[model samples]
Structure formats: C-alpha cells, structure tokens
Target: MIDKRCSDTELVSLYQTGNEAAFEMLLHRHKSRVYTAIYLIVKDRYEAEDLLQDTFIKAINTIKAGRYNEEGKFLPWVCRIAHNLAIDHFRKRKRYPEVTLEDGSQLFDSMRFAEESYEDKQMFRDTRSRMRDLIKELPDEQKQVLIMRHYLQMTFQEIAERTEVSINTALGRMRYALINLRKKMIKNNIAYDENFYPKRFDQVSIPRGQQGPDERD
Candidate 1:
C-alpha cells in the first residue's frame, strides 16, 4: 500500500521512480484546494474540472521532462499554474471582468524572519494536520478568497474580477476569512504562529528540488 503519510517531496520521488500511485496520492491529497483555486477563477464547475485536468497534464509533462523543481513547495507552485491558465482562458474569450488596479503592487504583508519558522522542525505532520482541521471548517467562498489572496498574492481587484464580485465584496470575504481563521485557532487553542502559515505562500525564491509541485501538487 502507498504510504499516504508521505511528504509531497517523497511522493514526487516515488512517482519519478515509476510509482503511479504516488502521483494519485498526491492528487487526492491536494485536489480540493487546487480545484477550489481554479473554480474561483472559472466560476463554472465543468470548466473548472476541465482546467484542473489540463493543469495536471501540464504538471505531468513537466515531471516527465525532469524539469519540475519546486520540491517541498508543491501546492503554491501548481496553484500558480492553474491561476495563469484560467486567466489565459478568460483573456482568450474576452470575458475577463475589469479591475481598477494595474499598478502591480503586492497585496499581502510580507512575513519577515520566515526563514526561522521550521529551522528546528522535523516534520509537517503537526502543521499540515492542524491546517486541514482548520480549513475544512471554513465556508467554500471564504476558503477561496483566502487561497487567492495569500497563496497567489492576488490583488483585491483581480480577486473581485475572478470571483464576479465587487472589490469591496472580495475584501469583505477576506476579512471574514481571517476572522473565521482566528476563531478556529482560538477555539482549537492553536497558537497563531506568524511564520507557520505564510511560509506556505512564499514566492519562488527558495531553492527548489528536482520535483516540482505541478498544478495540483
């Protein structure tokens, strides 16, 4: 049996060694957030599903090419690909909603000292498990807003366009998301670690491995 507890990096290694189940496990594990990310942009279940497949296909191609290199950083990398593809589709159809911001400034607060977050850590077991617990409780829209804003660094305008809501509404959803997250953390007594979560949304500056986190990794 495939060890479902394997780290994403470990799963990628196994997949590269001809273990097809490893890729399946990786897909099963991350499908929700990945699909959610795409769904938010496409806003149609069927189209999102198709885009999801296309995203994974691109990811698999990258893996086969032996150029995949995001390593432990899987979800964010693939999520980016999905987001880009969705944007391209909108552009091609000329169906993209207009947004007010084009200055290209970042919308998130950068986490300083993030490098020390897991310096002494041995595993993601505790962190990922806790995150799953918190995430599952969030409403779908709130979850989508949070994912795009933090992980993708999506501007509020872009989020509003993709979600088919006004900018204020997108901002409101993000507000509620943080409120819900805080409530969940307090309810579960999960101490707020500034670095623990934000590090997951980091950009591609960190050194990468030979296995990349594709569209759904």
Candidate 2:
C-alpha cells in the first residue's frame, strides 16, 4: 500500500521514475485543495470539476513529455496550472456566475467548517449571495474583466490577450468594476468585512498603450 503521507517531493521523484501509483497518491492528496481553489474562481461546481479533470490530464501529458521539472513544491505548480486552465475556460465562455454553494454540498461543508466561527460562516454565505447580485448589475465589459481577474486568477496580460484588449485596459476595467461594486454594495445596504474583500481588486494593472477603465468614458 502506498503511504498517503508521502511528501510532494517524494511522490514527484517516484513519478519521474515511472511509478504511476505515486502520481495517483499525489493527486489524491491535493485534489480537494486544487478543486476548491478553482471552484472559488469559476463559481460553478460542475465547471470547476470539469476544469480540475482537464488540469490533471494536461499535467499527465506534460509529465510524459518530460516538461515537468519538480522544483520542490509540486502542489503549487499543479495549482498554477489549474488556475490558468480555469482562466482559459472562462475566457472561452466569456461569463461566470459568482461563487455559490448550489448543489455542491461537499464544497459548502468544506468552506463552512474551515471557518473558525459560525458567524464567519454565515458572513461568507451572505457575501457570496451579495456578490452574485452585484455581478449582475455590472456592465458587460466590467463584469467580464472582473470575472477573469478575480475568479479565474488571470493576470492582466493574460486577460488582455484573451479579451483582445490592451493590458492597461484590462486593469482599468477591473479597477472601475471594484469601484462600481463598492458603490452598489453601499447603495444596497450590504454589509461585509473589508478584510475579506480588500483592495486585492486594485492590484490588477494592465500594460500601457491601452485604454483605462474609462474606455467607455
């Protein structure tokens, strides 16, 4: 029997030596963390599951092709791939709903139980619902940019290429989207913890030679 507690480094080394069971063990250990991360960004349980499978398939191909270099943190590398895959998926689809529990009882339980306080759990649910409503109110362009940047974890440059906009344009749109969302939340009397929704939105900067958030200016 494979030791479930084998470190990522050990599993990766074994995989490089052609031990398929090591790869399986590695996948089992990080599957939930990876899937949850993707689901958080994509906000769709079914779509997240699909993307998770697709990510592992790609990883397998990369490994077979000798393209996977284990620099030690295997799970992080896998997660980066999964994150990019989720972003690509969203770019092709062009829209995403806000994160939700929906029929994903396992995911909900994982997130809720992970929270240390019952109040925190309730706040998470409420915040998710409010975010869903806010997303619907955004202009099409703003909404698309926000989804790609936040949910899909795509960098501004990646978003620019996918959306056919300049990097700067992508950044500006994200900034404006946050501003609009903040305004909407205030206007609608929605309460949330800023720590949970910090200015992480503003860190998205687009490249130059592109329009800013006011492109619709």
Candidate 3:
C-alpha cells in the first residue's frame, strides 16, 4: 500500500512504476488546487470540472510516455497544463467570459476571500482585471518568470529548473518584473496597498525586505 505520508515525488515515482494507487494519492492531494486554478480562469463549475479531468489525463499520458521530467515539481507542471487549457478555452471562444457573482463566490472560496463585503468583492474583481491587463503588457520573459513565481507560487529553484535558467536569472527576471509592474501600477493609478489590492498582488508589485543572509535571491 502506498503510504499517505509519501511526498509527491515519491508518489510520482511509484505511479511511473505502474502502481496506480500512487497516482490516486497524488490526485487526491493536489486536485483542489488544480481545480481552483481551472475554476479561476473558466469561471464555470461544469466546464472547470471537465478541464480538471483533462488536465489529469494529459498528465497521466505524459507520465506514461516517460516524458514527464518535472520530477518533484509535479503540481506546478500540472497547474500550468490546466492554466493553458483554460486560456485555450477562452481563446477558442474569442472573448473572456463574464464572471458572475456566483462564479466569483466560488473563486473567493478557493482564494479565502468569501467573507468580504459586497463592495470589497467588487474592488477585488476590478483589481484582478486591471492587474491581468498590466501583467499582459510586460515583456515575455519577465512575465513568464512573474507568473511562475507569483501565480504558480514556484520557488526560484523550481522556476529555474522549469525555465532552464540559472536561479540568479530567475531572480533577476522576477526583480525586473516587479519593478516594471510597480511602474505600471502607479502610472495606471492602481493602488497596491492592502485596501485596494489583494495581499498576493501586493507581493508581486513590492519586493519583500531581505529577511536574512541565507535568504535566496
């Protein structure tokens, strides 16, 4: 039997060895985050559910084909697949879907924003929209690093591995991404304070202070 406490990498190894239960454990562990990532973009429960299944199927296929080289970084890899599929859904439709309050409620639930007042919800939506636009305006490498770091919440090591760059390059791209985003935020009059932006957005626009000598760049 697969131990429940096994790390994702271990489970992935077991699955690749033809132990199906290991894959089930991996799915149970990460399905919530993966689904949330899909729901945030598609904003439709049924559609998100479909895409979530597709995401895992694609993952399973890649693993079976021995093409999944992400190793310990499985979640980010799968999440990127889900994100791409969600974006493709919109691309095929030729327009972004309008998010309703109901859809927003589900998104807020996943994001822990469900308790805010109606006004705060509206502000959150607007802020997210504006931030997306600003992010799209960024240069490709900077934007890619920013999304992996901020959106995928990947560590510099993981980002470096995924992007095939040195850790320093990943850090440099993030620094420039934040600098450019801050400039865009100010020029567009989008407040980065807690009152106007989510804490996540604040992190993207403002670099945190150096915590210690051991802190990674």
> Considering every candidate listed, which one attains the maximal lDDT?
3
Q: Give the lowest summed-lDDT range of ten residues in model 2.
A: 104-113
TM-score: which candidate is best? Answer: 1
Per-candidate Cα lDDT values, in order, are 0.67, 0.66, 0.69
After superposition, the stretches of candidate 3 with alpha carbons farther than 4 Å from their true spots are: 97-151, 154-217
By descending lDDT, how would the candidates be arranged? 3, 1, 2
- Compared with the true structure, model 2 gives a TM-score of 0.49
Candidate that beats the other on TM-score, 1 or 2, i.e. the better one: 1
TM-score of each: 0.53, 0.49, 0.50
- As a TM-score, model 3 comes out at 0.50
Better of 1 and 3 by TM-score: 1
Error of 3 at 9 (Å): 1.6
Q: Candidate 2's residue-wise lDDT over 1-217, tens digit each?
A: 6676566777777887899999888787677667757765565567778989998888888877878886766665777688667656655654433332222112212221222345434545676766665765787667767765665556788768766778899899998999999999899888787578634311334566675873333
Candidate 3: residue 182 lDDT (0-100): 95
Q: In model 1, how many backbone clashes occur?
A: 1
Candidate 1 segments whose C-alpha is farther than 4 A from its true place: 100-145, 150-217
Better of 1 and 3 by lDDT: 3
The sequence of per-residue lDDT tens digits that candidate 3 reaches over residues 1-217 is: 8776687788888998999999998898788777755654454567779999999999999998989898677887888788667656665654433322221221212222213345534644676667766776777668667766665556898768766779999899999999999999999998856565323211212245845543443
